[model samples]
Target: MIRKIRQYIEAQNLCLPETKIIVGLSGGADSVVLLYALQRLGYSCVAAHCDFHLRGEESFRDEQSACTFAASLQIPFLKTDFDTLGAAHQRAISIEMAARDLRYEWFEHIRQEQQADVIAVAHHRDDSIETMLLNLIRGTGIKGLGGIKPKNGRIIRPLLGVSKQEIMHFAQENALPFVTDSSNLQEDFTRNKIRLSLIPLLQSINPSIEESLVQTMAYLNEAGKIYDRHIQEAIPAVFDEESGRIHIPLLKTFPSPESILFELLKNYGFESERIGDIAHAIDSQSGKEFYSEHYRLVKDRDAFLLSVRTINHEPTTYLLSPTTREIQQPLKLRMRLEEITSDFQIKKENAVAYLDADILQFPFIVRKWKQGDKFVPFGMTHFKKLSDYFNDHKFSKPEKEDAWLLCSGNGDILWVIGHRTDNRYRITERTRRVCCLMMECG
Candidate 1:
């Protein structure tokens, strides 16, 4: 089993000779075997354990066993305790998800601090097969079907070629002592239910179910590689990093736009279920928008704009006093109070707004656009609803959400700030004091 693991590591190019590795030691049979194997293979190894505090005393026992095992081998042991339930509540996520996030984040930190070449986890063929099954049950694309990878970035899974039976046999042969989590016997979690009930039923149907699933995942991984190649080639034509947008024309050049879009956006927190809706909107309308946890996608005319959602805990409305020269919150703007002269010229740019200071009130309000908001657009005689103005300008939902309005003290719109200005406050030849507002985005 050790020879097979060594050959697999060499073939996959997972780790270089004499590389420093950090092993995720959970005190389980698989992880204990992994730590022992890496040490025997002549690599500088450290055992890192995470006690999620989910199983009460069992969790602490696991940590203790892991530390003892590392000490027996004279390897450094790193451990951390987490308030798993508290983290789940704070993140508004499931306990399993919170634990997984905490585990990986801490592992990465340990790897960096120790200057380890790669962080190795004890995930075998059974775990990969289970992952593929879970993704399939949830309705996944090619990427999800590809299952677990042997090496992903700085994380390497050297035990992927071995089965659970092989790992158990090797552990017993080597007289490796390990602790088992009591939670594994419980059927509360989805993974536990699948492992305890679903996998046994499947094995009853076909004795070689795990092997078959592994083979299928191998084929799917190859197909995913091809899919990734096409996406990389298509990205140059479709995505523009300078403008931070995706061109719709180039996206249509692909035969499977829906699949291509799923592959492109899956990493950006977009779920597989939302990709079809996004693909449909790509051809249906130009103002449709979709949102994920960290990013937003807007379908603009002939393009899709991607932007990070800003979280502002500060007050949304900012005040500009009569003597104020600039305001920076929400957006950057330079305010200049000057007397309009015969040589004074109105700037043609929309970002620069010149208003009549005498007609406006003090403490100008800078806030986001609201529903039913209306303003007399510059050069227009009648009032226009801000919604209608947004529609006329073909603003997407995300654009409308991001739009800020500069208004007078009496709640009258003065400028749309980077788009249009109100006619009520526009500078005229009869005006004496001019309030020049210039927006600086770059």
Candidate 2:
């Protein structure tokens, strides 16, 4: 078993020579075996446990046992306790899901603080099979059948290629310490029901059920990559973003509006059923909009415009110079000038503004607008709400989020830049000289 595990790690190129690893120990048999096997295979490991205090004293025992096991190997140990039941009540989810979310959040926090290069989880072959079945039984797409990845971002599951039976025997053979969670043997949770009742029934037909499902998942994951590539290449052209709106043209253009809408709505985190609703909303006239936390898809002309809506940014400042760094996307900025030019101009197809450089300061900052950021609209006499100005201009949700302003360090508004230029800095005939400013995008 040890040799087979080593072979799997080598085949996958699992880890670097001395990479720091944090093991998520749930005091279960699978995690226990995974922790010991990683150490046995010559890797640096630390143990971290999440105590959700749902099972009263039993939760404390799991943390104690997890700590002792880490101490046994002289590995660093970390633990956090949470009001798991309270969170479940607040979120209206089961204790299990709340605990799951809490655990992963803490693991990420610890992973960052320890500067651990990789987080090793104990998700064996059988668990992947169970996940596949669970996703299929509920509503799922091709990506759902893909199961869990061996490495996602900073996470690594070294035991993915290992089976639960193999992990159990290895733990027994090494006299490893582990805890038995009674919930695993129950039929209450959906996963437990599938693991306890469904998988065994399927296994009766094929004893190698785990291997078959694992292989199927590998194939499905590969196919999902191809499908995603097609989605990425065509989605932008089919769905347009203009003036902070999201719209889909593929409804009339493509034969399958359902497939196109799914991919389009996905950009805004909308699921398949929601996509069906969003597609249905197209019958309404323009100005029809659907909103999410970060984005909104509105019906506009012939296309469905997807716009981002949520913003919570503390304004920031940046310096700009001709010889300095290249100005990039989604920025409103100002450039420095020693003196006013005879023809001061800022020219873009949509953005064109001129200023008198004599009164303008050298150092300026670019950041998001504040609550009461009133600016003269170049030819206007009064100030308008920066937010209201954006809404009145029909700036799409994303445009508002990406909107920025160049300001003097002394709190004077130079120009709103792309959306609108400020009148205070607008060049006039009375001005002695003009400073030209322009914006170019690749």
Candidate 3:
């Protein structure tokens, strides 16, 4: 078992020899075998365990067993408890997902604190097979068929090359003490159902089904390498990083455009179904928008415009007193009171707005533009609707949404900031003082 794991680690370049490793020990057979094997191979190992507090006393029992096992080996042990159910309710996620997230997050924290080279988890071959089957049941792409990888960033699974049966046999042969969580015996979770029932039913049909599935996953992993390379090479043809746009015509020219789109967008939190809808919008009308949790993708006339969603929870309104010099949030701006002198020439730059200091009041308001907003152009005598002004300027939807309005305390628009200043607030010949507002460049 040690030799198999060491070879897998070397092949995957997971870590260096004698480097400190943070091992996730759940007191289960798989994790116990992994910790024992890693210690036997002469690597510096620190045992880390997470008590999710889900299974009543069983949870504490598992933690105690893990702590004792690490003590028996004279290894350092670290443990943390989590309110798994509370976190799930708070995060609006499943209990299993909440526990998984909490466990990995705390493990990474411990790894960095201990200065470990990498984090090792015992996800054996059977776990990867279960993951693949789960992804298939949920409807997945080609990448999902490749199963769990041996290494992902700082997380490494050294036991992925060994099966669950091999781990159990090795644990028994070495007389290693481990505790079993009763949750595993109950078919309450989808994964447990798969292991306890579905796989057995398939095994009854074909006794060697697990081996065949593992072989199939091996083939898929190899094919996935080529597929990934193709995707990376083809991305340059359709995506423009500088403008954050994907050329629709070029995208449609590719075969299986939906698959390409899905691969490109999956990391942006977009699901497969939404990605399929986006692909279908290629021939549809422009001005359509799709939203993920943190990203917004707009179907423009010629391309897809992708941008981050403006955080709604952040303050949209900001106040600036006469003595204020600058503000960083709700957009950056530098403000100062300037005097009108003989040689003082008003700056004509669009980004610099010069307001009459004598006419202006303290505590100016800066906020996002809204519908039915009206402002007078610097040269025009009449008020113009902001929507019309946007249309005349050919402002895109994103640009209009991002526009900010600087106003007086009386709720009158002072400047359509960074674009045009209201005529009512412009400095005139009688103005003894001036307020210069400059929008800082990013």
Top candidate (lDDT):
3
Each model's C-alpha lDDT? 0.89, 0.75, 0.90
**What local lDDT does model 3 show for residue 288?**
94
> How close is every model to the real structure, measured as TM-score?
0.81, 0.65, 0.78
Writing each residue's lDDT as its tens digit, candidate 2 over 353-380 gives 5677667765556677777887878778
* Model 1 collision count: 0
Clashes of each: 0, 18, 0
RMSD of 3: 4.5
**Clash count, predicted structure 3:** 0
Please report the candidate that would top TM-score against the real structure.
Answer: 1
User: Pairs clashing in candidate 1?
Assistant: none
- Candidate 1: global Cα-lDDT? 0.89
Candidate 2 has its poorest 10 consecutive residues by lDDT at 329-338
Residue-level error in angstroms, candidate 3, position 263: 3.1
- Worst ten-residue run, lDDT, model 3? 322-331
